[model samples]
Target: MLYREDKKGNRISALGFGCMRLPQDDREKCGRLIDSALKSGINYFDTAFMYSGNEELVGSLLGRYDRGSYFLASKIPPALCFTKKDFERIFRIQLKRLGTDYIDYYLIHCLSDYSAWNRLCRMGIEDWIREKIESGAIRNIGFSYHGGTADFKKLIDSFDWDFAQVQYNYMDEFNQAGREGVEYAHSKGIPLIVMEPLRGGSLTGKLPQKALERLAADNQSAASLGLRWVLDKKEILCVLSGMNTEEQLSENTAIAESAAAGCLGEDEKERIEFIKSAIRESFVIGCTGCGYCQPCPNGVAIPACFEARNNFENGKNHPVFKMNPARRQYLHSTAVLGKSPMNASLCVKCGRCEKKCPQGLKIMSLLEETAEVMEPAWFMIPIKAYRMINSGKKR
Candidate 1:
């Protein structure tokens, strides 16, 4: 397997076994998979505090291994830290969950906005992080970002981040943090760890027949092609895949073992660009989220709403959306925030959003169209029922 040197010149494996999707229903099987991955030269293991018992699962599976032999990466959820004590409590809880004395790589999880970063700063998070690093409890500090490119750069410049993880794939070259953010972070000497390299498995199975034919002509497995495309970028330090099956794990490990740095041929590069262009053409809305259309007068999260609609249509079976039950609840609750700011239907034909949109997306018309598509009466019935049930339980 290839290795890369971090800013501190530490050698980290090119392939990190993400423990967020470890096999379940059989503890022994999980151990064997861990053993196999380690035997195959994988030394970086990643998990999070909220990955559905993943910390404990990986801890049990890999706790017996010599501590110095592997690198463990874990994160603390930023939303859970409303106070200084809360930050300490969460970090301590994470360490115990992983059965480790110190985390090799630590991160602020799901940093999606400037607000979250400000909250951390106001709560003295940097001082705390420095203490952890000084005490050797955390070897490196980073963040996993899911916000816009500008916000991402703001966070990178706001702090001396050791690394950053972003969702990247051929189809999402300009989505979320996008390629520019990756390149900017790399320029600052921050190692980039890529998540969702397969777009949560969307790029693999059930491709359009035309796309499949193009890929088949190359005699390459769709999975290998997708992984190779991401690994081709030398700026990417590690690509994390949440593998749930042994076959998937074995295939990825094999690909990682043989992967060479900057290895994409001219033909492969052209094919991937063609595939990306085709996928973009299929999108219903072309919202690049440049944030030119910001400060929505009604407080509606316009771009986010459109992005959610896009994902709902194209990524119905994507694991990240399905696994987080809270996202649906949050959407439903926020849909009733205020009269105008609440739902897409509340767009009062104000042309302000469209006027500012860099893509000239006709925001008012699309809002009405999106409401009709996603928030019909039938959809509201179940959403209302879910809210009612969940509300009573909270009470």
Candidate 2:
């Protein structure tokens, strides 16, 4: 596999295995995938404290290998930190979970903007990081970002960070911490680790028909095309993919083996633009499902609502009579299987989510549209019945 050097001159694998989406039910398959990744020479593993049991899972799987052989990365959630002691407590908990004394790369998880980082600064994070680094408990310090480009630059300047992880891809080139942020961080000698290189599978399985046809003409699968686009840029230190299947792992590894800066020819560049245009035309909503606009006061599942609507709209090319799976998906995710109804219709137009969205979307109005399209009488009747039955059972 290809390699890139970080600020400390550590040779990290270009293709880092993202552990957030590891298959929870199938331990054996997960182990084999992790094993194959290690055997294939991928040395960087990324996880986080908030990824729910991921650190323990990664620890158990990778504990067999010599610690020095691979670079293990994980994040401490700043949202969970309110005081100096909280940082210490969380760090200790993460260490126990990972079964490792030192984390090779440690990050402030999902730091939104400069103000957020500044809050941590007031809580004595800088000194805490210094002590950890001096004691060899933390090797590299950084943050994973989910804010705009302007705030991103300020955050980089605010800290003595060794690296920064951001959501970047062909589709998100101009979105959250986009190309501009990538270049700005690179200029300051901060190595960039990219998450969501495929935009949470939107660029792969959700591609429009025209985009798929363009890829077919070039003999490229959507996953390979998306990954290569990100890896081709020399500024990127590593591109993280949350691989859950063998096919995804195999395809990604092969792409990483031959990928280099400026690997794409003119013909390939044009094809990517064509694909982008096709997606733009078909995409009904630009939500990245980042969950920044989460926990609505009125209990609206904001991201899930947008995702289902996008899925429904993207299926326009399918046969007219066929029931869109997105409809069922919406019902299942928002009401039927959930403890309470969290569908788009629950939106009260409070506009609280709009202030938090990194993409600057008109969330309140878009949610109205979602309710109109996704919450017909047929869907709502069953959801209402389920809620009544469940509530009565509780009583």
Candidate 3:
């Protein structure tokens, strides 16, 4: 409901609606939720080429509303673009997908390094972006990032970008772009669009009792507290959260309207650090389970693999591999949900998923790590037996 401006003087909702995962079914209900958000003053809408049906659904739902009433944002995935024609082809297709002639915000999706940026330049993407801007097919050029801090700073300074999106949360303050990236982008007069402000729902989950007591002083949910922490930064233009329900939309909008920079006092800030410390102490793989890196060309159940490994390491009962809950769940994913009982050993070390990941994880290495623990030949028999028992329970 609250608004902030980008460097170009465009007013964006502080709580932008991330259209990455709108309900694929029940679009009428989806329309109602989006309409409710618009009525509540949310004007910034974000979608992407890689988000499956999100852009198409957003186009269909927003068609009833005037185009000028809200800002439309989407991305161009360089990995999918083999040639300049490929680059421009997708942009035209995106406009058609969204039923809009001009995208208010257009980004180079999931950029990670200078070599990649150079390749885009070599493919004539930079000029093509300009042509789109000049012709009014795209407006306010920018990028969404998943990279090292140094690379982030390089990219931000490299372009005359209108804004930039990054994976920023209190938990990842030193991980991706971190606090330094925020300051550098601001110094160059670039407004920041923060993604994963809730760390993909990790921050919204229950914290330790002592940590909860610290946040209880403010009378807010952990989710609210997490959102506010990002919204609290003045340099941020908007923080995007993918809300799936009306209740979540309302709660997020309310937080956006009220959260301001420096609103968290010293004690509250310290409390956040305490909770963050606890989260850091838990030995878990840092996958948010966003499923962005998915449908592995090789049919590897990548996200499921990571989730199982994380649960194995972090779950209280799963202190060791033999006792890990992920072992059971890992089998469930491939056996019940997957086509076969695929595990990390199936990985070919292809780096396609890494490029898509917002968290910038070393996925192939992690998959290998997962296989080392979960794919021992001696454990296969027990794991399969456990899977059969779990299946029997369902009957």
Candidate 4:
């Protein structure tokens, strides 16, 4: 695999392994994937506290490998930290979860705006990080971001970061942190690691049919088209992909092996823009379905709700709501048939999920919109009645 140097001069693989979506049911499969990644020369692995049980899984898999052979990166959730003690508490928990004493590259999970960083500073995060780094408990310090370019620039200039991670892709060239944020980071010599290069798989498996056809016409694989687009930039230190299958691993590694900076020709650029247009035609919401905003206090299945809504909007067939597969999927997955409803309509406007979302989505407002479209009173009344009756039978 190709390599790039970080600010610390660590030779990170051009393709890093994202450990967020590892299979929970298949430990053996996950193990093999990590082993294959290491053998294929991928040294950087990224995970976070918000990714449930992911740190332990990654820790267990990497435990077998010698420490020096790979670099493990994890993040501290700012939302979970209110005091300086919380930082120590989470860091200790993270080290225990990973089964390692030191994290190679550590990040402030989804630092968001410049003001959030300032909040962290008030809570004594800087001194805490300094102590950890001095004690060899943390290697390099950085942050993952999900805010506008102005805040991103302010944050980058505020601190001497060793690296930063962002959600960057061809489709998101001018979105959160956009091109300007990336260029500013590069100007300051802050090496960048990219997450969601495939826009949570939307640019590949979920691409509109027209976009897929265009990719086929150009003899391009969907995964390669998206990945190579991000890797083409010299400013990118590593591009992270959450590969589950062996085929994904192989395809991604092959792309990383040859996708040098500025590899895209004008023709390829045009094809990408065409695909973008196709996507935007039917794209209803900007959600990437990352599930970072989760476990809603009100029992809302946020990501699944958004996914159903997106699928419905993107579908070519104009099926009636009662006969729609999207509505059916939403009903079943969100537990509309169960004792308690978990659909978008059930959202309580608690605003907790918004704090956790990496995309900085106005989730409460979006949920209101989703409920209006995906869960009409005429459609949900019968289901609610059935549940009321079924609830008695179970009791």
TM-score of each: 0.74, 0.93, 0.88, 0.94
RMSD of 1: 8.3
lDDT of 2 at 67: 92
lDDT of 3 by residue, 12-114 (tens): 8889989886887888888988898899999988999988888999988887899999999999888898899998789888989999889999999888776
Ranked by TM-score from best down, the candidates are 4, 2, 3, 1
Q: Positional deviation of 378 in candidate 1, in angstroms?
A: 12
lDDT of each: 0.77, 0.89, 0.82, 0.90
Deviating ranges (above 4 Å) for candidate 3: 206-218, 316-327, 336-339, 348-365, 368-379, 382-395
Give me candidate 1's TM-score against the actual structure: 0.74
Residue pairs with backbone atoms closer than 3 Å in model 3 (clashes)? none
In model 2, what is the error at residue 261, expressed in angstroms?
Answer: 1.2
Which candidate wins on TM-score? 4
Residue pairs clashing in model 4 are none
Query: In candidate 4, which residue ranges exceed 4 Å CA deviation?
Result: 316-322, 393-395
TM-score of candidate 2 to 2 decimals: 0.93
Candidate 4 per-residue lDDT, tens place, 1-395, comes to 99999997899999999998788579999999999999999999999988889999999999999999999999999989999999999999999999999999999998778899999999999899999989999999999998889999999998778999999999889988899999989999998999999999999999988998888888999899899999999889999999999899999999899898888888889999899999999788878988878889888999999989998787645445446677777888888888866889778897889987867789999999999999898878888788778786320
Per-structure clash totals for the candidates: 0, 0, 0, 0
